[model samples]
Target: MKILVLSNMYPSPAHKTFGIFVKNQVEALKEAGHEVEVIGITNPLTGKKNVISKYLRWITETKMKLIFSGRKYDVIHAHYVFPTGLLALLFKKITGKPFVVTAHGGDIDRMAKKNPKIRQWTEKILQEASHVVAVGEALYQEINEDYQISKDKLSIINMGVNRDVFKAYPKKKIRRELQIPDGVEPVVFVGNIIREKGLSELVEAFKTVKEKRPQVELYLIGASRNQAYREELNQLMGTGVHFIEPLPQKELAKWMSAAEVFVLPSHIEGFGLVAVEAMSCHTPVIGTEVGGLRYLLRDGSGVLVPAQQSARLAEAIITVLENDDLKQQLIEKGEQKASENDEKKMIAKLERIYQQIS
Candidate 1:
């Protein structure tokens, strides 16, 4: 089968970590014996939103590529529902190809709520697609509630963690490479440094944890290119609190291996991919009971706290860090859960979806 993968959220030479989940699925499809062609826009180092020029470039490129290319696609798989799916909808009209759109949170929750015009378009896109994919069950429910997409047309298939890159490593070796001090338990967070990720609340919670456990350290990974948010988090980056720029997947897995616990306090997440990766590294995770975390951290595999509640988050972190039995249990169960969502399983599910849609 041939697939045309469409999205604006693809990684480029400038920004390597951008929508890498979508890229992973594309690669998986290729490995599964499906031919795949990608048509998308890549952002600059700043990671800015699409402008008028970008929109024009994307549509024009899509038309030129599909028309000029000799190969015909069996399915058009688009990540993100609004504009990228909208473009796919246009291409479908032209080529008479069936398309599937994957809703990755922001489009359904944020953009749909911000403007009626986008909401209406997104509704049409969801309704018209041959099939839809939601990264999490919460988002799947939201899509059903909001747009009334039929059960047969939608499925929950999360982005998988690469076991090769995210598997466990020797903690001491990784800690030495990272230059983390001995005798200090590291609590880590890896994501965009933004408000919605609950960075402020995380800092507050860490402060509380610090009072209880003096030997622990906090490491904030990922890009801090958002100057205002970075500045806001500046005062808290002292003593045991550390900030590191975004590391590649292998490096991040080492950090996860070194960490005593991985904390994700995001108010909203399409899918908590990083938490799964951390779990795959035998690192127990403490995440907010919101969005994908509810599903990802199931069956006591990892600790989940209420979103934006610094006190609860702090308590959960402290409990995980202090209790050896609980930590070991979480690590053991988390590894099992992580294995269930491996790339092979996810790709197999996707192959079924593609067959259904095609």
Candidate 2:
């Protein structure tokens, strides 16, 4: 099948971890014998002027591609619902082809709530799409209840873990490769370093944990789009915290493997993909009981704490670090959970969806 993928978030040279799941999905589809073409926004710049110009250029490029590409695609798949789906909707209307849109959390939880106009557009986009994929079960329920999208048209399908790249490695070897010192328990977080990701809360929690276990170190690994927020976080976090830039998947997998525990304190997440990757690397996860994390970490798979509660977050971290039995149990269960969302299975499910719609 020939597929055209439209996504507003795609990895650039500078920000390779940004929207990396979308790139992985595209590559998986190609390996499965499907022809795929992508039109994505690769710039990781911020600021009002840059944002406006970036979208303007993206719109112009998408319009040209739809107009001039003589080879018709079997289906159009969009990542985000509002802005990116707008282009897929346009192509579908002009050519009478079916389109699918995957709602990756913020589009519904944040973007749709921004204004009445965007909310209305998001609803229309979901309504018009041939199928909709919600990356988490909570998102599936939200779209059904809040957006009034039919259950028949919506499915819960996470961007699964590539076990081949994320599998467990010897902790000592991985730590040495990454230059991580021995005798220090590293608690790692891999996502955008922003306020919404609960970085402030994580820093405060880590401070409490560090006092109890001086050997524990916190690693914040990802790009910081907001300069002011980054500065504020830097001020809040003193010694014992390492701010590393976003890394590619292979390197990130090594960090995950080397860590004592992986933490994701996001206020909202469509799906905690990083947590699953950590699980695949035999690293236990500690996440907030919000959004996808609630579903992902349920039933002894990983430790869960309330969002914004540094006290609870600190307690969970300490418990995981101190109790060897609990940590081992979490690792075993987390690996099971990760196996259920394997990339090969996910791509096959996606292939079936494309076939059904086309």
Candidate 3:
């Protein structure tokens, strides 16, 4: 099958972790004997002027590709529902090609609610697409309840954990390889370093934990898109907090493996993929009870605290660090959850969706 993938997010040298899951899916398709062509935004710079220029260029180039590409694609798959899906919808209208749009959280939870115009556009895209994939059960419910997209047209499918890249390693060995100092318990968070990701809350929570346990260190791993917000976080953050840039999957998995506990204190998440990756690395997860984290961390798979509650987050972190039994339980259950969402299984499901639609 020949597939054309349209995504507003894709990794580039400047932002290797940006939209990397989309790249992973494309690779999975190729590995499954499907020819995949991807058109996406590689730059993650976010000034207003830069955003406008990049989108314009992306749309123009995508239009040209749809017009002049010699080989006919079996299906068009879009990652985000609004702007990217608009292009897929255009191609479908012009050539009668079936298109599938995968809603990856922000497109629905944030982007669709940006304004009435965008909401209308998002609705049209979801309504017109041959199929829609919601990356989380919560997102699937949102589309169905808010947009009235039929259950037949919508499916819940997370971008699964690549166990080969995210499997467990000896924590001490990984720490040595990464040069992590001895006598420190590392609590890691891997995601955008923004306010919405609850970095401020994480910092505050870490401060409390640090007060009690001087050996505890917080490692924040991801890019910061907002300079002002980054500055704000820095002011709130004192010692014992380290900010690291985005890393490739292999290196990231090492960090996950070395961590005493992995935390995702996001105010909202479509699906906390990083938590699952941490689980695959045999680390316990602590996340807020919001979005998919509620579903992912259920049944003692991990610890959950309310969003933006630094006190609660601090307590949970301490509990995980101090309670060996609970930490082990979380690790065991988390691994089981991660296994259920294996990358190979997700790729098979995606391939089936493509075949069914095309």
Candidate 4:
């Protein structure tokens, strides 16, 4: 099988975290003996005032890349619905080949409503695609209901995890490198710092957690996309709550492995790939009970609190921290579930999809 992956999220050397899931899936397909090529995207924040220039640049760059190369492949696996999916749909029109699409939250959940024209394009392409991949059950439902896409065409395969990187690391060395005291209980929040991610609630919960255990430190490992929100968050942090930029993927696994608990208080998540990585490291996760998070924690690998409920988030964190037996149970269950997302399993499933579609 030959596959052409279309996504804006493919990781560049400058930003390894970006489009990593797309790269992982492509690798899985390739390891299954399929050939893979990528048409990665470039997303420039579209201003209400500058929408024309943004679209022109996007279309021009994409057209030149796809038209000039004229690559041949049996499978076109498009990661997002709008630009990537739309572009692939056009490529198919020109090349007369089949394609598959996977919607990873933002396209259907965020972009669809914000811009109706893009939504129309996405739906038309999805309606014509060979197959549709959903990251979780909620997203599966969301895609089906939103577009009236048939259940037969849809399947859920989560983003793969690198178990080798996420597994238990030398916590002492990682802590020393990050300059943290060993005795203090450290909890990490690792994602883009934004309101939708529920960072404010994490800060509030951390304050409550500190009230009970003063030695506890909250290490936030991300930056805000919205600068005004960054200013807003800056006001909430103090000596106990430390903010840092997102670490490299390899170093992040060490940080995840070192932490006592991994917290993701997002209001929405297509899939909690980071949470899976933490559990793979034998650390318990605490995530919001919204969107794809329910799918991630359904097996009791982690604890869930009502989204945006700072009090419950605080309580869940405290319980996971203070109760040793529960902590151990979560770790055991989480490690088991984490193995299910291994690259080998993901590759096998994707190979089946490629065969079926091609």
Q: Which structure among the candidates has the greatest lDDT?
A: 2
- Once fitted onto the true fold, the runs of candidate 3 whose alpha carbons sit more than 4 angstroms away are none
Q: List pairs with backbone clashes in candidate 1.
A: none
TM-scores vs. true structure, each candidate: 0.95, 0.98, 0.98, 0.93
Tens digit of lDDT per residue, candidate 1, span 170-251?
Answer: 8898898889888889999999888899888999998898888899999999876578889988876556788888777888
Model with the higher lDDT, candidate 2 or 4: 2
User: Which order, best to worst by lDDT?
Assistant: 2, 3, 1, 4
RMSD of each: 1.8, 1.0, 1.0, 2.2
Per-residue lDDT of 6 in model 3: 95
Model 2 Cα lDDT, one tens digit per residue, 29-117: 99999999999999878889989998999999999988887249889999999899999999998888899999999999999999999
Model 2 regions lying over 4 Å from their true place: none
lDDT (CA) per prediction: 0.87, 0.93, 0.92, 0.82
lDDT of 4 by residue, 4-51 (tens): 777866666666666676787777676677777776744423356555
Tell me the RMSD of model 4 versus the true structure.
Answer: 2.2
The TM-score measured for candidate 3 stands at 0.98
Candidate 3 structure quality by residue, lDDT tens digits, 1-358: 9899999999988889889999988888898899899999998999899899989989998999988972399899999998899999989988889999999899888999999999999999999999999999899998999899999888988898889999999998889999899988999999998899999999999999999999999999999888899999989987999999999999999999999999999999998888999999999999999998899898988898999999999999999999999988998999899999998999888888888987
Question: Which candidate, 1 or 3, would have the higher TM-score against the true structure?
Answer: 3
Error of 3 at 110 (Å): 0.9
